[model samples]
Target chain A: MRDFRHDHSALALNTATLGHNVEGAGAGWSPERVIDACAERGIGGIVFWRRELAGRAAAIGDHARRSGVEVIGLCRTPFLVGPLAERDATAIADDFRRAIDLAAEVGAPVLTIVTGGVAAGTKGMGESLKIVAERVAQAVPWAREAGVKLALEPLHPVYGGNRSCLVTTREALDLCDGIDDEALGVAIDIYHVWWDGDLSRQISRAGRRILGFHLCDWLAETTDVLLDRGMMGDGVADIRAIRAAVEAAGYQSFCEVEIFSANTWWKRDPADVLDVMVERFRTVC
Target chain B: MRDFRHDHSALALNTATLGHNVEGAGAGWSPERVIDACAERGIGGIVFWRRELAGRAAAIGDHARRSGVEVIGLCRTPFLVGPLAERDATAIADDFRRAIDLAAEVGAPVLTIVTGGVAAGTKGMGESLKIVAERVAQAVPWAREAGVKLALEPLHPVYGGNRSCLVTTREALDLCDGIDDEALGVAIDIYHVWWDGDLSRQISRAGRRILGFHLCDWLAETTDVLLDRGMMGDGVADIRAIRAAVEAAGYQSFCEVEIFSANTWWKRDPADVLDVMVERFRTVC
Candidate 1:
């Protein structure tokens, strides 16, 4: 495994972590500025949600090429299983295609896929998984052609119904297996999978198929599922242990930092956030 | 399984659910009164925590007996793998023994165990689980002799560090398997295990060994881990689906209601809390 102890040249910052930082003051900064900030700090890469890069797609790509900042992976794009109008499905698919195009332009290695949550006003887990499976099968070929492997990210179960139906590493791998796509795998995030009973087994199963690695700590008493993410060493997650397990499973990849703390890290200065992240990355992660 | 549509006589109030109602100005009712209230309502049983009964232990048994309140199970007792001084370990053991004795007095069928989180300053997952296993093994005999089956409730990963090291149903069951005691099993609380991706498989494995069933909805936007639990139908949990799965696995037991919402539910009247609980239980669980 690549040593993270030396430098953060392999570290990728998910822009959402700093979307609300002081650097991104008015209506939050653009993706171009997000890349610039990472470059300023000698950070190596950026993993961002393509949807967030809407009007500035070309700008982001151009800046990354000029600045030598490797865009690690696009945060996500996926089909949420539900009864939507045909027009809406077409629009979503087009959006995903555009995201794939953007990732290729920026030299990103992968496009994260988080199969959307249960359909509206529904509670059936089996039905949701089936819907997700069908949608993912349809998208695999397109992703492969774009040269961007789809990184399926299973969210935590607290988000089982509303956020993402794909909620396990094994489940994501199951999708990969069903679709039979070399272009599809999983983005293993410790914050989401650390609590899983089958974590060690699943990490080993993921092996070379772990397309991405996201890091963030889960607070002992989590206040909000969407926003209360703690800094690396602030919470109780045994991150290093999980990282070791992931490494042992043959995932030699960037340790992407993805924190969504609207109340804590979001309000801090972006420079401070990056500084502390680097310090913790060296000592804790 | 058992029909809950008719009445909650087959259901048990876990007290923590009633915690929200038992707080505030006119809500300083003791745990003894909580039992009386359950009995008055013809509630089938109560699964209580020793802390709730600590102050009233002197008279709790007599009160429960007179009121015909069945103590279904004692909620918890476990010193997670913390580095307790010799005195601390003794005190913890003594406290649990007392809890088991009180549970025996009240005819509680089980004493729930909650091992402490990882020892202060320690960081690995293996060491964490090892500590919980050692602590739980030591308490098995006392719990067995007290006629109280020790039910280990694996808390969610959110509490992996400070509250309990056992963070999955499988982990708890593995501990039970290690102890190999008829007196040891697991307390399956939906709040904690509902988010588990392998929930169905684990619940199936738990089968007849599931000593208790605790229910509460997981709000899509949970604000606190210690509290902020929603009423059965007020949140996103597939309560009926989980209940169906558990029942199918041969757990013919009371569906204990256990919400800990200090903000919303706790501020309401006890009567209102009970009324909403009854309605939700009928429709949701």
Candidate 2:
């Protein structure tokens, strides 16, 4: 297990934790301001959401690098196949390609993919998953050429209906297997998978295919499944244990903190939230 | 597969669907009243919660039988293991025994078990699951003598922290395997297992060990993960497909409708709720 206590360089801020895209929530920190704040705290990296990028991916990427911080990853391509997805297949393909291009422009090594939930008119997950795989396969060559990895993030089962039908690490690994592309892998978020009994085995199964590791806590009495994510040490998730598993599986990279707290943390100052994340990252996670 | 439209005898009402135990919620319909109403509608069976039984298990069981309605099952035993469990193992064993006695007294063949979530002072699910299995093993003899099957109900992964550590049908079946007792089985609830990619395989694995089949829908935009469960056809779940899987696995039993809707159904009249359940049970499920 790596000691996160003394070394804060491995800590990465997932901008969503600072309330990026949520409507009317968050501190509303600009990209440049967020970069400077992270750099000031010796934070190692930053994961930016597309909405926050605002056509400034190249400039933001350069600014972070200049400030001695790395652009760790990007937060999500749009829904590839759900109710919110673009109905036309070509549009979906084009949208994903643009996301890949954006990641390359920002120099982000990984682009997180939240494949949307049950497709329109589809009754089950089977068909939606197949569509996700077919779309990913179509986008793999472009991703590889861009020198970026596509990280499929299997959300918690609660999001299976409309957010991301990909709900298990094993399912993500299976998708990776079928695609058989080095450009594709999985992003393991403790909030999504800590409840799984097979988590340890599946983490081991992911091995080198594990592209990104996300950090957050699962409150025992979560009021809202989507936006009530707890900060590390505030909830019941075994963060150190999961980190141990991920590291053992050869995942040596930034530990991204991606919390979506609509009620609590989002209401706090971004600076205070970042400071708490740093402390929690050291002592708890 | 069985035509629920013309024949509602296969339709069973889990009183929770009519808003029975939620705090300050649901129309507080008495057990007798619920039984009489189910009987009038030609509803096949009714599953009661322990709280609603009010020490009238024997009388209520007799009442349901006389009314030509089966007491299909009991709602749940107190959590066997986890932070919510009584620390003293013997107390857990005793409580479980009492619950088994109640199930037997009520003439219910199965007692649903929601093994509690993360254990006190424990970090991961492994230890908690072991504790659950050990406690269940200790109570098996009592259940067997009472002729009450202990049906482990795997809650949704969202509840894995404090509600139930047993969050998958496969895990429940695995627990049953370790106990190796015919008296121990699984209650397959569509809401909990629908998100699982391996649900079909796990359902088949359960086969004869499936003691009950619970019906409910997973709403697309779920507002409350615990309390906002949709009535049969109102949500996007492929209820018929799940029923087909359960029936294919040799579970020839009532399709129990167990929903926990705090905002919608619970606010309606119990009779109206029953009417909608029958209509949707026929058309949707």
Candidate 3:
């Protein structure tokens, strides 16, 4: 395993971890401030959410690059095909194309895909997954044109019903197989997949198709499924082992810290949260 | 699939659905009352928790049988191994034996095993699962002697850390394969596995080794991961499809209704809860 105790450059900040996803949640740090703070800490990269980027993708991308930080990726496109997705299929396709364009404009190598939860009136995940595959297939041309990859992030099963039907790395890979687009891959997040018994095998199968890797902890007693993610060392996940597996599978990218602790870390100073993330990245993760 | 609408004879009430698991949660209906209520409604069977038995397993079992209601199964044995398991291995083994004796005394054919959460100081689920398999292997002799089958229930992956390390039906079957004992099998619960993409395949693989089948719904916007389980039909799970798969796999056992709805069902009258369960079991499941 690569040693992280003395090196901090591989650490990346997923903007949502600083409370960018939820309205009125964290320290409300601006994208510029977040970038400067990460750069000040010797952090190597930042993944921005669409909501935070507003119309500033190009400027933010340039700012991060100037600050010696890579634009790791984007948070997500709106649900491709689920309850939250645009009702019209064309709207969904247009929204996805715009996201790919944004990824290209921002110089983000990957655009994370959190395929929305069960489609309205759908009885099970099978139908919704099929819809997701169809939509991703349609968007492949745009993604390839933009020179950006679409990283399907399978949320935890807890989010299967209403958040994202894509709930496992294997399922994500299966979707990738059907699409068969070089621009499509997976973003493996420990919080959503640490419990998976076949995680190691799936990671190995993913290999170079692993576009991004996320870091966070699963609290022993998670009070809230969506917002109560623990900081790396504060929970029971075997971070080092999972990272070793990812690295062994040829993933040599930023280890993005993507916590959503509403009550704890999010309540602290943004600088403090960044400092702690860097510390844990070196010591725990 | 069997028509639940006209015939609830295949329906089994798991006591926890009435708030038996949490203290001061459900209407304080006694076991005798629960049995009589099920029989009156033409409900087929009832599954009791160990706590409710309170040394009266024999009498309750006899009464239920006399009332034409089967004692389908037992709620659980204390976790065989994990963070919540007893530190002394012998104690875990002894507790399991006692649980088996209770299941036999109650005339229940199967004892549900919720193999516990992550083991203390364990970094990953692999080590904890091995411990669970070893412990279950040790208790197989006692289970066989008591004429009771141990049904390993794999909880949702959300509970992998503090509730159960066994988080997939596939993983549960793997444990059964390791033990290779006729006394061991799996309990397939919809709430724990509706999101599994390989659900149908795993059910087919389980075949006759499926000792029990549990029913419940997964609410689209789940508020609580542990206690906010939905009643059948109230959530988005394809209960009938899953039931079809289980029945196709040669599982002729009762469809056990086991919801842990702290905010909704538990607050209702016990009779009202039972009535709703029957209504939904017929219409939704």
Candidate 1 residue-wise lDDT, B242-268, digit = tens: 888889889987888888888887778
Docking class of 1: acceptable
lDDT of 1 at B285: 84
lDDT of 2 by residue, A1-285 (tens): 888889989999999998887766555668989999999999999999887787889999999999999998987788999887888999989989999999999989999999998987777798899999999999999999999999999999999889999999999999999999999999999999988878889999999999899999998878888789999987878888899999999999899999999889998888999999999999998
Model 2, span B1-285: residue lDDT tens:
577678889889999898787765555667899999999999999999888877789999999999999998997888887768788888888888888899998999999998998887777688889989998988888899999999999999999888898999989989999999999999999889889988989999999999999888998888888888988876767778888998899988898999899889888888989999899888888
Q: How high is the TM-score of chain A in each model?
A: 0.91, 0.98, 0.97
Output the number of the TM-score-best candidate. 3
Q: Write the per-residue lDDT of candidate 3 for residues A1-285, one digit (tens) a residue.
A: 778899989899998888876666656678888899999999999999887788988999999999999998987887977666789988888888898999998999899998998888878899999999988888888889899999999999999888899999999999998888799999999999999988899999999999999999999888889789999988888988899999999988899999988888778778889889888888888
lDDT for A89 in candidate 2 is 93
The global Cα lDDT (0 to 1) of model 2 is 0.90
Better of 1 and 2 by lDDT: 2
lDDT of 3 by residue, B89-201 (tens): 88888888889999999999999999999888877798999989888888899899989999999999999888899999999999999999899999999999999988999
Candidate 2, true inter-chain contacts retained: 0.70
DockQ of 3: 0.84
Task: Compute DockQ for each candidate against the true complex.
Answer: 0.36, 0.75, 0.84
Model 2, runs deviating above 4 Å: A22-26, B22-27
Candidate 3 accuracy as lDDT: 0.90
